[model samples]
Target: MNIFSLEGKNAVITGGGSGIGLGIAKTFIEAGAKVLIIGRNEEKLREAKLSLGDNCSYKSFDVTNLDAIPDFVTETKSNLGNVDILINCAGTHLKKYAVDTTDSEFLQVLNVHLLSVFALTREFSKVMIKRQKGSIILISSMTAIMGMKQVVAYSTAKTAILGLMRSMVAELAVDNVRINAIAPGWIDTPMLHKATDNDLPRKTKILNRIPSGKFGMPEDIGYAALYLVADASKYVNGVFLPVDGGAAGGF
Candidate 1:
């Protein structure tokens, strides 16, 4: 057996119109999986699809719309087949001190990043369980591991996901469905640029923490996603792979 092959897989990636999500979609498709990406940006999705080639397509939907999840899952399964892999990569970032963070803002981020993730996973796991095999990838963050100020909402949501993954592991494993997470380090994306572009000191501090002394690219996470979902990692289940250039271990 080819350990790295995803040749007959069907992958669904959320937040896949741009950045890391798009990167995963592209890489997955290249690995011979048919990819259907979900996001709110139709134009960006179209552009992404064009670049990802014939095996790629996309759907436009706001994840916060909890009422639409069942239908979306049904439609996705119908359109894409059994959905061998599900990549939960959609989320928003809010930077604010714990005191300054509004109740509304915190809940909004949770609804998108945490709650919707649950809804989609619950819905998709139904099909995957019946098939007795599937890979579910959760996109976690560095904030989830290390404490960082001014991102209370984002941090709370991401940290909560670790709990979610652990709780579901034993149950999901019983049915042969694997759930894992990726905690990415400071990646060089427009969002990261926007976060630190004005603060050289902050950027420098972040870079210093990373032993590699450079930010990672989206494809870095993409390739990691492929390993988690592909044949190579069949025995791996519920592990959080931190693709952080050794940042997590820094002093």
Candidate 2:
């Protein structure tokens, strides 16, 4: 049997309605995993469900609603059976200088990108622990490792993910639950488009840094995620894998 096969696995992917999350969900379905995607936008989720067909489903919920995550996880487990994979892909990015960012703005980013992730993972780990088999993949960013301007809150939240991934792996490995992170560099997602809209100079500067000489596609991250979530990566834990097209190596 192929170690990459996920024929009977059930994956719960947050933010799976669009962008990198959507890409990862699609890849998992193609690899024979049943995927449940959660996002705040009903329309996007509906579209994703349509595109993904019977093996994929969606739930409309804001991940930042930390108080409700345990209930959400419980309901998901009941509805979908055991969730063998948990992908924390929902995040918010506020592009503002540290000096200009308000407290609420910073907290809001942290709420979605960090706090909610921690809460959801904590809840899901119980289910995984009982099974003694699972994979948890967190979507981090290149900004987590490098200093980037006008994204103070986003960078901080992303950096926190590394620590979270490492700590979780340490505690969860005993239970046979693997935890890891992906730090993507400048993927061409809706968020990236929004960040680079009408800023040709900045866009050009970014493109020039990538050794691949092009921005990464969501599918690129998707394939990388597939490897991590599948049994192919059973021995890989607590590692921050960079799918950045050599951007990390360049700078």
Candidate 3:
């Protein structure tokens, strides 16, 4: 048997219309799984589906709409049958320091990154527990592991995700439902470029710090995510798998 094969598995990837989420969707589909990509942009989702082909599907839904999640989960299950994997990659970023950040902004960030994610996990893990099989991946970031400027809200949410994963594992592991977090380092995505393009010094500083000496590709995170949900990692549980190129551990 192919230990890495995800054949017959059905996956739901939030924020899968672009960047790392889209990369994960592509990898999952290539590994023989059916993927449903969700995001707030219908056009992007349509384009992603077109590129990913028939094995891929999509839904345009705002994750922050917490009340809509239950219905969304129900509809997804009805359409996709059983969700073998769920990826919480949907999030919003705020580039503001703590002093400048307002209460509304911080709460908004938490609502999307933390609250929505928990709701989805709670709803989906129930079905997985009943079936006694499932893998859930939360997309975390370097900010969660270390300090970063102008991303206090983002860091807090990501850090909380790790806590959420660890807490869920205690309950879900007994049923063979594994939940974990992937902390991706600086990736070569539009988001990264947007943060670095005009700030050459910052970009250089980031690149210099990474032992790999270069920014990582979105697929880098995808492959790590694939392993977490694949049969190869069945024994692994409640871990913070960092896909950063030694940046988190390096000087």
Candidate 4:
């Protein structure tokens, strides 16, 4: 039997209606885990459910709505049982120079990327503590390690996630609940395409920095997520695994 198999595990993936979130959901389902995806778009959630088949489910809820997270978690647990894995993949990015960024813009990024993630994790940790076994994976970014132009707000939020992951690991590991993070480089997602649209020079510059000579596919992160969330990484904690194709290690 594969030790990494997620059979019988229940996972909750945020922002799971599309992009990296969707990729993770698909992979988890393939590994025999029951998935409950959360997103703000009902139509997208329905579409994702259709693609994932019966073993997968979804809920329409915005992660930014921190006040309702506990209730949402409660409802999900009632419907699907205790969640064994939590993937904080819900986040937003604002591409603008620091000077051009607004206070609201920065706050919005923090609200979704940091505040909401913390809230959801806190709620889930309560349950996991009772169970004494769980895995939490936060979706961080390469920008968290290096300075990147036109994404000051996003960079700040992503960097904060690393700190959050480490802090959670320190506190949660004692209870046998593992916490970690994944820092991805430029990935070939809709968000990346939108960010680089009509900016061939910027896109080319990013591509050149990646030693792999191409943007990472969603499946790359998916595989990493599976490893961390499944039994394969049961002992791993407080580590920020970079799925950046060497971008973080390059000049």
Candidate 5:
């Protein structure tokens, strides 16, 4: 437990208004860390902060604004203290097929998932590098590895995340900054429900492929976040850890 304890650490999580982002923030606070969450909706962020209690606070800022990252990082540090961990979890899901997806749609997904991730990490790593310690985690997806239908843009962006992690880790590891990605399987979230409720066949296909035979909970990802952000994973870097319930490995 001591190794997993995030005592005295400061964390900033993007998309922390709900779903996996909020889940990670809750887990970090429980592990003894203070957290600052970022989101586009002020009301949602406020509700999340209330739910996560005094240890957690939030700011409203859409991560898709690549140009705003540097200023956001500066202001967050001036307000929230030095960031010891950063969780890049802000993303948009596109369920359209490759042939049907417009160029703009594809770019939108990339801008939100890929470019924003890089921009934020690069800016935050500058701060971490000077201090010589920090952890950067990316929330990738099962689409990164599996050839799932109707999510070409989403899959493309997620796969690119691993490359980004490795690229950044190569340079940051020397500064004691850890860079990693987490690929979550079919987690039970409202978003996932909406994505699948209308497509029963697609849902069945995903469930049948998963050996665990159960949908993953948000806390499953939270626990994985705990390990990576805490001292327990100080040696881990450039790894894409899957939090899927054996779905990525099953037939």
Candidate 6:
């Protein structure tokens, strides 16, 4: 038996049109899962679906539309037959310092990263629990575990995700529905380039601290996500696995 296989699985990945989410969707499709990728941009979603081929589908929806999530979940489950896995990788990054950050800005970050995540988790876990099977991966950040500057709002939301994962474990684990988090290190994604391209000092500092001496690839995170969702990791639950090229422990 192939313990790492995701055959016969149906997965829904938010923000799966690009970056780490797209990488995860690609990996899952390669592993024999039918994946539905969701994002706000219909064009990007269409492109992702085309690139991913027939095994993949896409939906254009914003995660911040909290009220629409329940209906969206129902429709998704109906279309997929049954959702066996979920990856909440939809997020936004703010590079503002705390002094300049406004109340609405903080709430907006929380709205997408924290609130919407809980709503989706709540809705999906209901189905997962009834079947006594499911695996959920929350895309956390390196900011959740370590400190970084000019991202106070982003950091706060990511930090809350850890607490959310831990607190939900007590209930979700009882029904065999595993929930875990992936704290990706600095990956070479457009988002990363957007944040670091002009900030040479910050980028250089980040590179020097990493033992691997290079940024991680999106597919690197994809493979880590594969391990967490595969049956091989059925015994694993409620853990935040970091895929950061050993940067989390660098000198």
What's the residue-level lDDT of 8 in candidate 5? Answer: 91
Off by over 4 Å in 5: none
What does candidate 4's lDDT look like per residue over 72-157, in tens digits? 88888899998999999986768899999999999999998899999999999999999998999998988888887999988898
Q: Candidate 3 — which residues are off by over 4 angstroms?
A: none
Q: Where does candidate 2 stray beyond 4 Å?
A: none
Candidate 5 lDDT, tens digit per residue, 1-251?
69999999999999888888888998899999999999898999999999999999889898988888999999999998899999999867788878999999999999989999999999999999999999999999998987888888888999999999988889889999999899998888877987899999988888898997889988889999899888888898888999998888897
Comparison by lDDT, 5 against 6, better one: 6
- TM-score (all chains, Cα) for each model: 0.98, 0.98, 0.98, 0.98, 0.98, 0.98
lDDT score, candidate 5, position 77: 91
Q: Candidate 2 at residue 88, lDDT?
A: 96
| Worst ten in a row by lDDT for model 4 | 228-237
- Model 3 residue pairs with clashes: none
lDDT for 159 in candidate 1 is 91
The clash numbers for all candidates, in the given order, read: 0, 0, 0, 0, 0, 0
Residues 62-144 of candidate 3: C-alpha lDDT, one tens digit per residue: 99999999999999999999999999998676888799999999999999899999999999998898899999999888998
In model 3, state the lDDT of residue 101: 98
Which digits, one per residue and each the tens of the lDDT, describe model 2 over residues 58-116? 99999898889999999999999999999999976687889999999999999999999
Q: Roughly what TM-score does model 6 have, to 2 decimal places? A: 0.98
lDDT of 6: 0.93
Choose 1 or 2, whichever is better by lDDT: 2
